[model samples]
Target chain A: MQKIINGKAYVLGDNIDTDQIIPAEHLVYSLSDPQESKKYGQFALSGVPRERAGLPDGGVPFITDGNYESEYSIIIGGSNFGCGSSREHAPFALQKAGVKVVVAESYARIFYRNAVDGGFIVPLETTEILKTALKTGDAIEINLNTLKLTNQSDGQTYTLVHPGDVLPIIEAGGLFQYARKAGMIEG
Target chain B: MPMTITEKILAKASGRDAVKPGENIWLNVDTLMTHDVCGPPTIQIWKDEFGGQAKIWDKQKLVIFPDHYIFTNDPHANRNVSILRQFAQEHQLPNYYDVGGERYKGVCHIALAEEGFNRPGTVLIGTDSHTCTAGAFGLFATGVGNTDAAFILGTGKIWEKVPESMKFIFEGEKPEYLTAKDFILQILGDITTDGATYRAMEFDGRAVYDLNIDERMTLTNMAVEAGGMNGIIAADARTEAYINERSSQPYTVFKSDADAGYHSVYEYKASELEPVVAQPHSPDNRAVVRKVQGRKITKAYIGSCTGGKMADFVAAARILKDREVKVPTFVVPASTAVARQLKEDKVNGKTIHQILSDAGCVIAPSSCAACLGGPADTIGRSVDKDVVISTTNRNFPGRMGSKQAEVYLASPLTVAASAVNGVITDPRDAMG
Candidate 1:
């Protein structure tokens, strides 16, 4: 029952810290409700008028606010995603917003583990795929079973391969799920 | 394989043979703590992943506090606290600290050590990067992602890559006013931000020995900013004495062998360091404080695992005790215990509270607060004239308030002095 959606796509580059993920002001709420803090992305743009021109209405579903179009079922960001605090909310917020998987060029060591634990599949794919296959508001389909991503806009498809080491965690539905399947707990 | 301090500690915690660099080993955590700012998201993931089971590990092993976002300025913060409160109740966590009095714990690093959660020869992990501060007490500590923390909570174990260690040999007379903070700042500037990525830094030299336990803690607390996985000082007599002064437990001594191998070696003199500041956007872009002084400041914040130490306060107090804070100042004590000590010191006026209040300083509950633009900041939108001098690590734009607002990083003493002058001024000049 992994929820799949052709949610709005918002693209961000790389090296986003937890502070940017959830500004210190919005951190006062529970992590389960990240949609409530979604508006803070405006803080990232400094002062120019927030250009949500290509963003989906009601804000982008899969990506943060103030982001534009993207075609990949995942985001192909630069080196180091989730580099700051150990705040798990960074990933949870993404998952809750319908990010089926985040395909980063590289990820901070800590953030990589956090994504899988939340059951948000994050596959490490080539950043080159981000060049043409993805554009803003293009609907993309994600298949958890096959780990495939398809962009309906141009009938493009890309095979999402989990990083060699991270495959096990994603297969188990996350760390806690994996722990249960390992019979480390009493039923 | 040669073992680094992180590997050595990981090996000890795992009850295994030495762990080599790049090799993954599961380690037993001596202490695991999370603050309100970082802990809530972790707890949510934990519950979503684990479902209705009392934690897989002992409750006594976990510590929870709402230190970062306690002022309840926005609805999101209020909801966040509510979630933490419920989690604390369901988990029945033994060390839950709220936002006031005995219930009030300041920053998680100081709270853990002062409350005896950081024991010698132990490994502690927190969701906050400053967790490395525990290394001052001879513990292996680092910040982990919420996912990692949740896994540890459920299994009482974590995975780590034994990092290589770099040795710094310092030999020289320490200059007056220059402190361990200045020494570490120089090291950061030399190495750059990515210099120590995934590396263990072992601080040595006669200069290190000259620093007391509190000052040493300041050095290690910000090691994360240097991309260092851990910062450790070989447990010497000073370390032993520090432990003995506070605890009844006996801890065996640990040190590098006479010829223990290191990945790299560095040498620096203590007397050579001047007041250094890491400009905004990066912690490695360090410049001499004198280079940035007189920069206008709109707000001044002094608190965090690094700046709220007793010595940091003493230094700030010595300069600002009877003075007025130039910009609106916020002083968040690192721990309730530190606050109590500040009270006992009779810091200038009738009490530390009255004295700080009279000096235009706003005393916030012990938490990260305005240091991270948490509810503690009431400043309006960022303006070109507004600059903030903060003791906390990291000055990324929008980190304190508006992205347009400027932030200058410095030591607590420097921050206090700057606040009194309404501009960035060297603490040495204020001392003079």
Candidate 2:
């Protein structure tokens, strides 16, 4: 696992639910297919503006239609990120779309587990002050070894908590790999 | 150290005498459930990662339900079932309830309990967030994602953290008009949606014990809405009897220590509570039913794991027995067993099913119909600009069918009463 990551951040608001991350309508594609990654990546945030059930009509999209992966690799979000639904596809889609780390004030339990168990993305916890300090398109650098995040754009530094017990899974590239190494399953 | 019920269950699953909050351990799952929406992908990932020759850790423990998106005729929806059917056959899975068969169950959460997988002192994981419903039986249960479920499919084990426990003591007797839905909505309203995130919600007190198993399940079912890792109630005589009727498996009954540590404790007087509804967009955006009265609606839906139990239907039937529904009302049984119970249950002289049918309610098949906003052909789906009062969890934007359609979540009684009046009517008003 990368101990340090430097990337641009995409900011999202509170309660970024599983439907908003990846709607049920776009989940028709089979995960068994070889092109599953590309299919999921393309539809990663398609529901951002139009699919949320009861919210307002429009907001700033975190991942636009264009090639966003090239410009951003981190997602900065408010409280209760991934609050609804136990769909792993939320994190899977973000990982497939090239999101590496998700920094949130807090996360829904299942999403935090999925991010760690699937090793699809790293979920880091920070204070509300850090959430307010960061902005979309800001150049951020995170050092897991040091438990700190640096905003290169503004020369600000913030403390972050590395999700414990998740480091081993990330180092092994996912739960299955970690399980194999731990001898819980046949290698 | 003294342990909460959640900690105790996790400790047993992880082969420990005791465990603490935030301690991660490998859990030997007693059961893992996957539905049609996530089942195919889970199977796919299992095959991809574990190889074609890998065998399931335990066929008896792996339950598959093709509940969501099953009634639709769309090819994509049909394909999901076919995949599950093929996988079940390939694995010779004993628990796969294929669609169009006598064994087909309805919602996975309800069927899990009905089929006896929700034994006390067991660790249950499902692909749906509502999997927490099983915790009502005095167990530790929570939802996982496709990848984690796939891992369980191959290993029969999951890595989990012991969540902190929050104790909710509901004092006093619940009013007749207030159902578990209203109680949970009141808690959600007070705590907001994320109040209990990453914690175990341990519900107890005289009020919770007074509730039947179905109503207890409702409390646990919506715990996820509060971002709770799981919701649990201790197994008493009622829970034991309920499990004994459905299952023969030997199980332990675990309870929290008298001095067990809790992250927080919330005490409520059940008698003081009123019928409440979660307003548009969020389950935590709640208001008293009296405040939202006369809000016109185009549709009324009464089904889903949260509201499709036999007791829920009986409550709705009590209100709609003699009245004709004013709007397009739909009643979907959560499972075939519930539907059968409805057919067999008599109110006065007519079966519950007959009363509902007589009242112009569309009695659909037992499935998660229109809950996840199924294909275009899904029955009871909300259309453009439709204001629907549903009993399903989650009214997020585009939740039912159309982004433009608005959804208000309420109790089955409230939904039935609202259906009769073509508006959001409080159950108390209609009961009179």
Candidate 3:
């Protein structure tokens, strides 16, 4: 299935930390209901209200029926996505908030690996075409099977292929899902 | 053939004749770690996902430290400790340290290093990103997620891909005033923060070899700060001498082949470098210490996995001996072991803790404390617009509470000197 993300982009300039993705303070809360975590993004910027209920223009997008609105699906960030700390909650919060894929110039190794293992995060290469084509509220379609990322605004397309067993894992809904299908887990 | 530190650790873990860059293999982790916050969730995941059993690869191979919120005055933190205690008992994990009444050890990285968990030619993994600190002892260490930590706890095995190696070559004489912290900060400034993502940084050259084990460990400890999975300094005679002083454990020597190829290489001359500090908001925001001089501080702290080594404490104590802490200073040794060493050296009351305590310093147990806000050490409203010059890793906003407050990263000596002056002063001034 190919889904296009359309929303005002709350683009990060570059080099976001796990603490910024989700503060250590939020980890104190119960992990059961993710909607509770919708307030998570508000804490990213300091001095701001703890509950910035009004969604940022490119806040987060949801392809699923029951997800946050203005909620962005695809995150177009600068180099080194997830640059600080090894908190899995960083990726978990992003996934729970309906971030389908992250398009960045590069990714921190631990973050890249953790995102892959979790399964929901699909990190695409940040090429010039994709970068130039992307803006706040511009739509993007990312096809998992073909690794095709299209910027709907300029009709620009990019194919990302890297040497790894990661594609199948993302397609299978992350490592656990892939492991389950591979008979690593008991039915 | 001289094997790189990475190859040596891999060989030991995999029982291979030799290993090189760019090979994926499962290696036995010499030491595995989890903190309070990450540990609780990983334990929950282990029970829910992997079932309750000590059916891991080895019983003696795991180590757990409750350093994150050891001084937590929060009710939720207290509850988490109880949950951790239950998990500890069920798993029979022998190494557990508590806080308050208990003899609290410092942060995990410092405790492990002091207790000899980190050694050359071994691979270590911790749930904390700063686990990369073990790289200082020539061990190949990296941080893992709670889920992966759970799998390791359940199975005692870790999956890893051989990474491309980048060599940081340092040459030249380090001035007496210059320390490893300055060297590393300079390197971070040179390479920027995201410089070595996904690569293993192998420290090389004459300047690196000159560093003592503690100093070298400080260099490797913050490798994650550069976004690298791990950092290694090839074990040499200096390393061998240091390891021999600490433990009788047998260590297989590991050094990169003279002709070993690195994917990328960088060089720095230590003599040309001066004290560098990471300004508030990011570790990569580098500036000369001279630029940030005279910034008044409300708190000045010196301790963390990265900067709380024995050497750092001793250095801080020396600068703070006759001086006093004007702000509400906190001088925590990294671990109980470091505290013991300070005591044995007779530098405790005469120089460090006592002097600072007499000067209104709030002495606390060795833990992540204010670095990660362990309740007892978090910031209060009174601290607004105040500055902090701390030796702990990361100077991100609200790290020490108030968003309006400023936090500066500097060496322990600089931090201690600033405490004495009640402002951000250079250690050079205090030395005189």
Candidate 4:
């Protein structure tokens, strides 16, 4: 919560569902095993069509072959991002791929909840459509305290929708940690 | 203040006399459903969070089904199923339905009804988006991810924001060719995928109540396609009858007041809406069958939680009877019971199964085969830019296997009609 978040941005179109995030076929890998779970990172965002894989410039890979980590650590998406399936693996894959935050116009309810509760990525809302203004590999930085995002590529700063009700949970690092700190769960 | 059925149900669960939209409350869940793909991950998180003190809040209220990735040969998929089996055995859960066993059920949503767990005026959370399918029975049901499900598994409680309800009224005598699938597709086309995000969709009107339980499920199952939190219907006599025959648990029945508030209301004449399909890559990309006819397809699929029920097959049989399909058509039942019914029931003296088989449709084992593009070897999965018209709920890129393939989401009647001609066809052409 004290750290400033910044990374290269990977952009995508609207309705990028869980299937496009992790795909059902690769859901078999173990999330608990370190070696096996890294496969989730390797396959992250592999299901997106080649034409929309990386926005502004299409077909740029999220993770190059033989690598489990992604170069871009922030994703810019249009409205209804993560619009299908309720798989927490979708968010987990993003986290595993080194993504620290996602700026999107809107989100499907379950995906938004999963991202916050699992402490995978910070899903910030943008009053402006970030996907169209940003290109893949643009450097971005997030202000942890004010939840502000600024694109270093264009020097354009965007205001995020106040994290409001779930801000405490995100700041505490996730629901489990939040509950522990709030004494909602017994240690 | 007046409230809709969804508001009433949430109010009762949250221990309030009345509640309004946008209020946050913790609901005491009545049941938690999980399937093979999500169950193992949920249990792992529960164990990790609680350590040795890990425990299920209510074993009887937790239902596990090894449905997804079942009937697959992939090692990783098999390992996932084993994880669920071990967890169920360790927990001694009464509701776990094992794969390759007598108690096995194909899909968790439909099986929830068959096992008498979908009681009215209850809150049910699950790890699959289609859990909203049970809202057809007049309950509060919605999908959650593994983390929220794990939290519920330990505490049997989860906080939810009350959602403003959208009302859809389908009027007029229900048309023979126009089923609930047609109306839902029409709604999707009009509203787009995110129209009802974080909200409730309540189905009403004469045509809605006129639908049987199976067909009613079809209408509610796709509510998630619109990003709805849940889809609900007020419990009428038909709903009560369906519940009474399956469950004997004492449950409260709640309804919306005549003055209940709604975010928006849409009225449609059921007779006027024609069969339509959500053409490739998006569920809301709808096109009328008449307008899209003669678009060639490589495959026709009839199955999934949304489209693989007995009523769906019955509709398909109505078109495929005494006819042959020109393209490769695959039939997958949503549940094992539905599969058994296809053999036991008859359409014009020939079994529905027989009619489908004679019509050159390949029938796969009951489970979520090829619907979500499961294992690499899943039956009937698309390949090589294959154009498929399927009855499943989703058609997102790579959802049914090949990234290069195109999928069109349609009702069973339209799928069957298209199957006969190897192209998208107006269902009316196949009707008597």
Candidate 5:
């Protein structure tokens, strides 16, 4: 695991559901076909109401129209983030759009498990709500070793909850890898 | 140690005598269900991980239903179903229900009950979140993503954290106007959407026990809407009758110990409740039907696993029997079986299909039409600024299509009542 990871933050408010992360209309696309899967990135977080698309101010697009990748590298959200469906596409879309980490006050269970088990992105639960504390497009540094998030844009810092039992899974880069290490599956 | 029914089911599935909440353990999955939306991707991952020699852990234990996006022009959507068909054909999996076939069942969740995959004291995991609907059988059930499902596919095992159970009790004779939808909507308003996160929701009391199998399914189906690991009711004679009609397989039943611990308890009297709806944009944003009465709506829909059952249609038919709807109404049964029943079942001496059609409801072919807003051509899908009253789960923004549209989630009776007035209306007034 990297000790320090740096990225730009794209924040959202509470109840940011899986439908908003990747709309159902886009679910028909392939997740394995390299070229076809780019649609997931292009439409990542596309369903969020325009007013709640970004934090602090909102109305910012995560990806430019017709583009398959996003400039944002990290997502900051309030409680109950990813609270709707169990579509793994929500996280797959984010990772495909270049998101490396998600810092939220909390998460819906299936989304949290999918993030860790799929090794698509790092879903970090913060002890406190930082959705209002952080702004979209702010420079940020996350230290996995220290479990702290430092905002280079505003010089603010926040503590994140430990990953607990899921830390090994994330470290091994998903459930399959973790299972291999544990000798639960044929290596 | 005393354990909740969910814990006990998990414990047995894991080969343990007891399990405490929050403990992670490997569970032997009794069944794994997947549908068109998630099945293709899960198969892709399973094959990739298990290599060229990939084989399903137990062919008979896997159930695949190509339900979502079945009646679509989208090539990709059709291709997904094709993938599931080919995979099932290769494996000779008897449980595979294909599209355009006599066995094709609509909406995986409702089909799960009609078919006999759900049994008490077992663990069922599916790729769709609403898979928890099977928990109505007193089983441990929840949803997982493609990777976890892929893991289960290869080994028939997946890891789960035991969840604390929450209790909901409703004590009263079920009112004629009150449906399971109203009770669950009331619970959502009280607990918010994430109130029961990572916990089991166990329903009991006379009113719950009074409900038939289809209505019980309505309660468990939306457990995922509240982030619950599962919503369950201990199996009884009613459950046995329903399961026995479809499946002859032997099964075990489980109930919570009298001394089991609960994370929380919510109690309500059924007689005190009235018609209710989860207002547009969120399931947790709730209001009494009377409170929102006269709120103008452009369309009315009655369908999906949450609604659209035989009982759901009977409720709607009772309200629409001799009246015409003021709005464009849609009635898409959750399964073809329900559709056939509509044609044969009677309401006030007329078939439900005839009554709904006379009432100006467009009876669409079942397969989850417009409930999740499929391809652009889907029937009943919401459009820009359209206000809809629907009998479906989850009113999240854009859940039924167009983000600009609004959806009010209500019971079939309430939806039918509202359909008659072209606005949100209480079922109580119409019942008279």
Candidate 6:
């Protein structure tokens, strides 16, 4: 795992639910089939515009034209990110779509746990000021060791509250890896 | 130090005398539940990560229920169940509930209670977010993802952080029109959807304790809607009686300390609360029923872990005894036990199922039939541009089917009234 992550940031508003991240209709793909799992990346953010209320023209699809994988690596979001559904596919889709870190004002409890246990993405809890300070396509640098995020575009720095106890699991690449290291599993 | 009920349960699970909020502990889980929707994937992960030689940590503690998307004829959904059936047989699990079998249960949450897995003073985890519903039994229960569930499958333990507690006190006399659904919607409206993020919602006060076991489950079931880590109520005589009727398992009951620390406390007058509806797109978009009345609806649904209990049906049946539903209405029981109760229990010399059927309501199979918007064949699904009023949680676009269809969330009484009127109408006006 890299201590410093630099990527283009994508911005979204409040209450991004699991359904918006990946709709239930697309969840039929078997996790056992690697060929079908690739389709999940394309469906990431497919239902966002429809579920979110009061957005212009049904809101802009965050992953435009299914090119988010190469275009963006970080998502900056408002409060209640991943607010509904306990589907791990939500974070898995984001991870498959090339999202490495999610900086949100807050997260729904289940989604936060899924993201950490799957080691799909780094869920960073930051202040609301970051929601306003960062914009789409902004160059952002995050230091996992220092819990500091720097907006290279605006020369602003924000401190994120470190999520305790789970840091070791994230550092070990996921819960399974951490379990193996802790002698909790036969691996 | 005095500890909240959640803290005490977590401390005990982690083998400590006491623990505080924000501290991490590894919990030895008592039960792990998974349904058809998430079970196949969890099993796949379990095999992929743990290899073929690994066995489940405990066969009795791991329960599998194939409820959602099972009634439909979709082959993919059927395949998911087949995978679960094979896994259960191979693992020799004792708690697998297959569809159309003698041991089958409808919804996992309600089945957990009826089967006595919701014992107090324990830690339970499920694959569904509504797993918090089990917390009503005076335990610490919450939802975990498929990966975490897989970890538990192999190790029988999970890592968790102790969450801060928020106390909500509902006082005053209960009104005739108000149900537990109404009380929770009021709290959601006041707190917003994410108001209690990363915290435990400890429900107490006169009105909550006065509620029956099923109603208490309703309150805890929707706790996840408010971003609560878990919603809990202390187990009392009501809990004991409810459990004793289902199972005679010995259990330990825990209570919160009077001086336990809470992040915040909210007090509400129960009598003052009105029948409310969560408008389109979000549960937090709540308004009083009178304000949104007369909005035409194409369908009305009363089912799911939240509102498909026997009490909810009784409330709806009271309003629709002789009245015919103007729009399509679906009556689904939460579990097979509830469905059986509906068939056996009489209201006004007729079974509640008969009343609902005579009222032109489609009595669908007891499962999460249309709540999660199952296959195209699922009954009561909202089609293109249809406006629906439902008693299920979540009104997100396409939640019940088509994105163009609008959904208004309400209580069973409100839904019945609206169904009879072909529009959103307050139950009081309909009763009058």
Model number with the top DockQ:
4
In angstroms, the error of model 4 at B151 is 0.6
Colliding residue pairs in candidate 3? A8-A58, A9-A136, A60-A71, A60-A72, A61-A71, A61-A72, A119-A174, B106-B335, B133-B221
User: Would you estimate the TM-scores of all the predictions?
Assistant: 0.83, 0.94, 0.88, 0.99, 0.99, 0.95
Q: How would you encode candidate 2's per-residue C-alpha lDDT over B242-353 as one tens digit per residue?
A: 8999999989999999999999999999999999999998899999999999999999999999998998999999899989999999999999999999999898989999
lDDT of 3 at B359: 57
Per-candidate clash tally: 15, 6, 9, 0, 0, 0
lDDT of 5 by residue, B1-432 (tens): 999899889999999999999999999999999999999999999989889767789988899988879888989889998999899988899899988868988888889888888988889999988998998998888999999999999999999999999999999898999899999999999999999999999999999999999999999999988889999999999999888888888789988999999999999999999889999789989999889999999999999989999999999988998899999999999998899889998766799999999999999888877888777878999999999999999878888999999999999999999999888889988986
Candidate 6 lDDT tens digits, B132-181: 99999999889989999999998899988889999999998778788899
Question: Judged by lDDT against the true structure, how good is candidate 2?
Answer: 0.87
Tens-digit per-residue lDDT, A8-47, candidate 3: 3335545666765766655554443455545534333322
lDDT of 2 at B178: 88
TM-score (chain B) for candidate 2 is 0.99
Candidate 1, which CAPRI tier?
A: acceptable
Write down the TM-score for model 3: 0.88
DockQ, all models: 0.37, 0.60, 0.43, 0.89, 0.85, 0.65
Q: Which stretches of candidate 2 lie over 4 Å from their true place?
A: A50-71, A129-132
Report residue B379 deviation for candidate 6 (angstroms): 2.0
Model 1, span B206-279: residue lDDT tens: 98878887788888877776667887876778777666666665454556655667789999877777888777
Regions of model 1 farther than 4 Å from truth? A1-14, A33-73, A100-106, A121-164, A181-187, B73-93, B248-252, B346-359, B376-385
Pick by DockQ: 4 or 5, better one: 4
* Interface RMSD for each of the candidates: 3.3, 1.5, 2.8, 0.6, 0.8, 1.2
Candidate 6 residue-wise lDDT, A1-187, digit = tens? 9889999877777888897788776777786676778777878877666424213223445556746353678888888999888999899999878889999988998999899898999999987556567777789999988999999998989999887777888888899988889887878
lDDT of each: 0.68, 0.87, 0.70, 0.92, 0.92, 0.88
lDDT of 3 by residue, B1-432 (tens): 555667667867987787776777778777787777778767766666655443555656677777776555577666667877786687676776655555456688877776667778878899889998888877888998877787677666666777778888889887766678887777788787888787788888788888888888888887888888898887777777767777777666677777766778888888887777888877888888788888788888777787777788777777777666787777677787776665556464374556555556666656776675435444321156768888877866556656566788888878887888888887778886
Q: What is the TM-score (0 to 1) of chain A in model 1? A: 0.67
- Alpha-carbon shift of residue B303 in model 6 (angstroms): 0.4
TM-score of A-chain in each prediction?
A: 0.67, 0.87, 0.72, 0.97, 0.98, 0.90
